[model samples]
Target: MRSLEIHGIDDLRVVDRDDPAPGPGEVQIAVEWGGICGSDLAYWRRGVSGTAVMSHPFVLGHEVSGRVSALGAGVSGPGVGSPVTVHPARTTGPLPERLRGRENLHPDLTYLGSAAGDPHTDGAFAQTITVRADQVVPLPAGLDTRRAVLAEPLGVAMHAVTRAGDLTGAHVLVSGCGPVGLLVVLAARDAGAARISAVDLSSPARERALALGADEALESAADMSEEITVAFEASGAPASLDGILRHIARASVVVQVGNLPPTPISVTLGPIVSQELEYRGTYRFASEIEDATRLLARTPRAEQVITHVLDLEDAHAAFTTAATDPASSKVVLRLS
Candidate 1:
């Protein structure tokens, strides 16, 4: 099988590797498509995603779709050749009272393509890869591999929206119009947000946000009214934080979904204290993936966010395009 592996910073390459077989309770999938996420580019560029250092050469994908090629001895239900999207997460330690219902908050968990720990969890960036059967989610009817590849990130967006609490008829603001931010717009609209506004430095990203669901997309908050009742900080840019705090209405909910670097930045904290605002932090996702699969199956327009699909042989090009092209949203790599 052909696999796209990252050896070090700026050293990603396509290498031939032996096919992996399913172990007990695991399933082997013939991957068809994988989305290029921001973290994936981080690994290619810096050999690390946050504190997750690249200890070894590993596959570089998590947002993937494939067909079940074989099942482990204990699993039997979703027979071979079934199309599926994977949840890509597994809890690895005893649950704590503080993290009972929120599994994604578990301190000890592993995700595909992440090098956050030693003997890092491998991901589905190959023509064939094996994963635990529990992570394999059979696709909902009419959801093809191409679009279903979005379920992972869409789940992240859904979870971020979940953190914002009820949006019923609430005016929402989303800063930064990256793929996840754009998906936040879609999810906010689905949650009955009265009006959705988005801000981004990139005009192309703003356009994509508007196409997804934002009532208006702005280059900045200069023209935005100070009426936003709920705000989501999805840009991860320090400057974007300043704008979000300046424009949101008094007593609004602000959910930070994007992963900011460990470094601290200076942002106006007066807004939070003076306006009596609520600021919440959100991580990856929990059980929202199931909902994401159903939503993707039901909404065809969601596929419009995928702007480019390149062949696996062009994996480097795919990463480059995903990182450099502001006009592109979700750039995917076709594996099989």
Candidate 2:
């Protein structure tokens, strides 16, 4: 099978590797589409993602859609040739009682393509790969790989909204209009946010936020509402915190979705203290991928979030575009 691997910083290779048969309780998939994520771009550009440095080469994808090619022993359902999307997380062990419902918060939890751990879990940007059967989810009747590829990132967006408690009839603010932030607008609307506004430095990104669902998109937080009921900061820019906090209403919630630098940067905490704001940090999703898949199946608007689809051979261009081009929301690689 052909796999796209990061040899080192700024070194991306589309090399051929062995594709082994699935072991027990595993499912082998022939990848159809793989979305380039911010992390993927980070790995290619710097050989690091947050605190995880890519000490060795590994496949670079987690947002993928494909067809099941083979099921291992004792794995029956989601039969051969079934179109599916994968939930990329794998908990290393049983969750403690305190973390029962929140499987994603497990300390030992790992994800595909993440270099956070020693063995560096491999990702799924290849022609063929195998993963645990439990990680696979069959696509709904009307969904196809093109749209299904968004389930992972959409899951991230949906989970952020879930962290905001309830947004029913609330005026929501989204800081950052990148792919995930754009999806957050949809998630907020789905949760009954009466009005949604987004802010981004990029004019194209702001425009995209409005096209998707945000009632308003601003280039800066200067003109934003001071009555924001909830704010989801998705830019991962530490500097963005100050701007977002300035407009967030008293006692409102702010969910931080983007992965900030491992080292802390200075930010004013007076809003949290003076206004009694509930500042929450949301991590990667738990089971929301299921909801995301179902939502994508029902709505045509979600598909518009994908901006570019490039062939696997054009991965260099894909990663570069995704990293540098604000006009490109989500860039996908066609594997087959």
Work out the TM-score per prediction. 0.97, 0.98
Q: Write the per-residue lDDT of candidate 1 for residues 1-336, one digit (tens) a residue.
A: 999988899888899999998999999999999999989999998887977889898888899998999999999858899999998888876879988779997887899999887887778889999888888888899898898999999999999999999999888989988889988888888888999999998888888888887899888865667778888899898778777887778888889988788777888889999989899999889888888888889888899889999999998888889888878889999999
Off by over 4 Å in 2: none
- What overall lDDT, based on C-alpha atoms, would model 2 receive against the true structure? 0.90
Give the range where candidate 1 is weakest over 10 consecutive residues by summed lDDT. 218-227
lDDT at 19, model 2: 87
> RMSDs, each prediction?
1.1, 1.0
* lDDT, residue 153, model 1: 93
lDDT string, candidate 2, 1-336, tens digits: 999998898898999999869999999999999999989988888888988999998889999999999999999979999999999999887899998778889988889999999879899999998999999989998899899999999999999999999899999889998889988988889889999989999988888888888999888776778768788999998778777776677888989999888887988778888889888999889999999988889877888789999999999999989998878999999998
Output the TM-score of candidate 1: 0.97
Segments in model 1 whose C-alpha atoms lie over 4 Å from true places: none
